[model samples]
Target: MAKFKYIDHGQGGAPACMTLAEREWEQPAGRQVLIQVAYAGINRPDCLQRAGAYPPPPGASPYLGLEVAGRIVAIGPDVRGRKVGDEVCALTPGGGYAEYALADERHCLPVPKGMDLLAAACVPENYFTVWTNVFDRARLAKGEKFLVHGGSSGIGLTAIQLAHAFGAEVWTTVGNEEKAQACRKAGADHVILYKEQDFEDAIKAGTGKQGVDVILDMVGGDYINRNIRSLAVNGRLVQIAFLQGSKAQIDATPIMVKRLNFTGSTLRPRSDEDKGLIAQALAEKVVPLMEQGKCLPVIHKVFPLAEAAQAHALMESSQHIGKIALKVQE
Candidate 1:
């Protein structure tokens, strides 16, 4: 079978300038299932990796995609809970941007009942991210206030909805009025226009100067100090990415003063066992939410696989309000 592959990284030029071509794919190995990918969701990590800033961990596949939804075409020996023709969504270590992708059994999540395969593709990356970093690491709980940056992003939108689903008051920052409305629709109690208002000030005012209970911060650098200031007593800040820049000069006083916890995680580098625990939790906890219509995947656009360049362009534009997906089937 033919699959799309990341042929090279383009450091100084546009993402489209980097090569993507169809290539012959091999069959699955032991404990691995070969997925006939129906749809693949594009994420920020894919873009960073393409720019040669982030490379896959040692021994990981060279292909560049983090999530996919499709049917299992072949199952390796010792794999359980799945069979050929079973529809599933999976967190890929790599090789997701292709017609056929291999996934270890632990990383696979079953497609929610009554959900379309394309829509299911959007669920794994965002849900796994929020579940691991926000709920598991930060220990966010009911009745707490949660604030997220880039509320219109795939990760942000998912976090807003899930935090609201589990009884937290949610707030988010967005680039424009349109995205702010989108955030509100996704269950954010308040939306701050980050380009206009200082988010720390707006959040403090919204909370009556009490600050939020947890902050899901993707922006680093200058946002670090303010994020500490925007937290309640014993608050938690979970960092998933540093879109602005990672290095920063900041005071540690707020963290010590407020007893705030600052931490973050990336899914790719984690062990298979850890990812399995997360997958199991998501399948039991979050999948029911989607089945009951309490939470769902939001797609900003779906481009044909051949238009992968355009899909990356749209995501890079920072204008899309939700997940951008690549359609593998007509």
Candidate 2:
């Protein structure tokens, strides 16, 4: 078998390393399909995997890619609705960053026509995260105000476009003025420069002091409290990650006083069946938005498979304005 070197972390706090002289192993038995990876998206979870904090579950591949887009080369027995030569993207619990990866049929999504593999690779993680947390969990509605932190990020940009396309008012917080502008260009109704202005104040001013109907937050800790205060009546705040440390001294009084609903989730920890449901939702709802060009994936850069370290460095700098992709094959 031809081997494809991948980026991985061994165990406990070690820096990410690449192993090139490795051989591709045979696929395991399951209702799965082997994909000849064309592109893989680099995500924050991948960074966690590289730091040895995140690992694939038992019975899953140890390789560290959560989403990939490519062509199907082989299918397991009893698989249906797909076949060899299909261009598709799917969520993976592990083993995404390689020449080939296995995907359960239920989680596979047909790539939209005319979409490049790199852009398709960028969609699954961000789209699934945004849709599940923002729409499915929070029940965001049309004409409601939706706010997202890290507005120019992979998740934030996806949320902005999807919410706007669904007739909701979209607002976001970005690190700099340039990113704020990029968020606006991506159909955000308003952009807050967290550097120059307090996001709470920006949100208040933007909504005439009514606050937002929903907020998608990845930065936890102190922002947890502020996120609640930033909500409208019956508002929902979905916490996705804690880039600023999870623990913090916060006042939860606002939750009762404002009657806000707080929720959050991690996609990689979810069961395959649940992920399949999210994928089905994406196929029915979000894919049409992509086909109409309303909520397409925005890629910042594409790095070759070998330079995975450099990709992590760029993401660490918090400088990227959209999704970063890895080109797995020429």
Candidate 3:
């Protein structure tokens, strides 16, 4: 049996726990394709998994990493559209940190024209989450006002660009001026310094108490109530993660009075078919924008596969303004 190198976090602790290790290779099965990974994206969920807070779904690989960009080297019997030597980016079911990984053929997407593997590696996790939650679940529409918390994050920047491209007004909350500028450069109409000013107050004052039409938030806890209060009459609030804390004491009055929609989702646990649909949507709608240099991913840093610990440290420090990736092949 062949072996490949991957990041291993024994018993799951801090970023320091991750180390390069070798694992026996497994052949592609079912509709899966084996990818010779060139790059793997570093996401928040990957950190959570390393810390033992988030666990992989049943039947999913227990390793870290949710997305990768590479060339398809082998395909299972049921694979049809993908084949050997095809360059693609994929949303993996886990184990993206390895030199090679397995991905459902339906969840793999062609690398956008003129985009490199590094940028392609950053696309699947952020794009799929933003598309499904902000558009499919929240029903964001053209000309509406939109706001996203953590403006400098990969997800935040993606939402800002996509919403602005689709003709919606974009607002975002950032920790500092640097992130604010980054968000503005990404097409945000309003950038609020969450540290210097109250987001709810800013929203209330900016819109004359009308609030925004939709808000995509990852910081839960107390922000939940403020998110509820900082909405227009028919506004929608989509929660993706709880960086602060999941448990919140929020008033239910606003939920009923405003006719608001409060919803959210996690990408890794979703069915393969659901992720395939999202991939199809991205290929049809967003890939053209990427080809035209619109709504492209912003990469802040890239580390060699062995330095995954340093990458995770940078991510947890919340200092980077865009996506982080690990170079797996070269």
Candidate 4:
């Protein structure tokens, strides 16, 4: 037994699955390494897991958090090169809300120079999702026009900066002036006040009615149909989440006439081999930018690990502009 705590909401109770309890963890297995977590990143999926809406994938740990950064405390026999005490940020198979977590060695990245564990913690989930959707799935190229909805969100901010850094002309929708400035500072060419303007009209006007090349969307609902209208011919709309809602009554005419493609993915359920590919791609394409301070994560706040419930409250409040993190250890 050790001084380890983890979030478990599976047991039936008042908050049921969102409860925090002490637990001892076994050593890493196969290519996995056990990490003494310093900080864990909060995400929408964590909130869903709390409410028992999103369950961990088969064979994954039954904990809430998805990503963490810390020192590697131990390594399994199959792991190579990486040794105990390596400073790393890793995408986990859940269980990041604890003092310790295990991750595949292939999924770990060195913490960039001048970055703390908190910033590193904020990187994995959002960056992995953005890279998988915006670049791999959407295939956004240099000089392409890209639009991101929910521009102030954890994943939205990362998408904005990454698209911009990759030489795309980025456009985004924000709720207020503060969020607008944040996106603008992240190199967005245009910030649509989603509350005050029709985003479809804004996209049309901003692109001279040509529409955008790709759209990275998390806001679903009517925006689904509107997203089709906002894309140019042969455009892609990658839906990563349905924050507003899903199940939209959309017209097929626009999709057919425009030759548009609609795709959606949830990263948690992806295979380890698939995630390892993403990890390698990120190491090559994105890590250098991170080292140079481009596409760095925008952290909104950091809550102590004991206050995991409060962290979820802030995420649901939708008031934060970027990633919310949990300080899990020293």
Q: Which candidate is the best by TM-score?
A: 3
CA deviation > 4 Å runs, candidate 3: none
Question: Per-residue alpha-carbon lDDT of model 1 for 56-165, expressed as tens digits?
Answer: 89878777788999999998987877899888999988878778888987889888887888889998889999999989999889999999999999999999999999
RMSD to true structure for each model, in Å = 1.8, 1.6, 0.6, 1.5
Candidate 1 global TM-score: 0.95
Report the lDDT tens digits of candidate 2 across residue range 288-321.
8777766888889998887777787788778998
State the lDDT of candidate 4 residue by residue for 1-330, as single tens digits: 665788766652333336678888778989999999999999999887777678788999877788999999999999995899899999999899999999999889899888889999999999999999999999999999999998999898999999999999999998999999999998899999988999989888888999999999888988999999999999999998887888888898988998999997999899888998998899899999988988899999998888887888899889999999999888
As a TM-score, model 2 comes out at 0.95
- For each candidate, the alpha-carbon lDDT, in order, equals 0.87, 0.85, 0.95, 0.90
Candidate with best lDDT? 3
Better of 1 and 3 by lDDT: 3
TM-score for candidate 4, residues paired by index? 0.97
Better of 2 and 4 by TM-score: 4
Instruction: Pick out the ten consecutive residues of candidate 1 with the lowest summed lDDT.
Output: 4-13
lDDT (tens digit, per residue) of candidate 3 on 223-261: 999999999998999999999999997898998999999
Cα error, residue 84 of model 4, in Å, equals 0.7
Per the 3 Å backbone cut-off, how many clashing residue pairs does candidate 4 have? 3
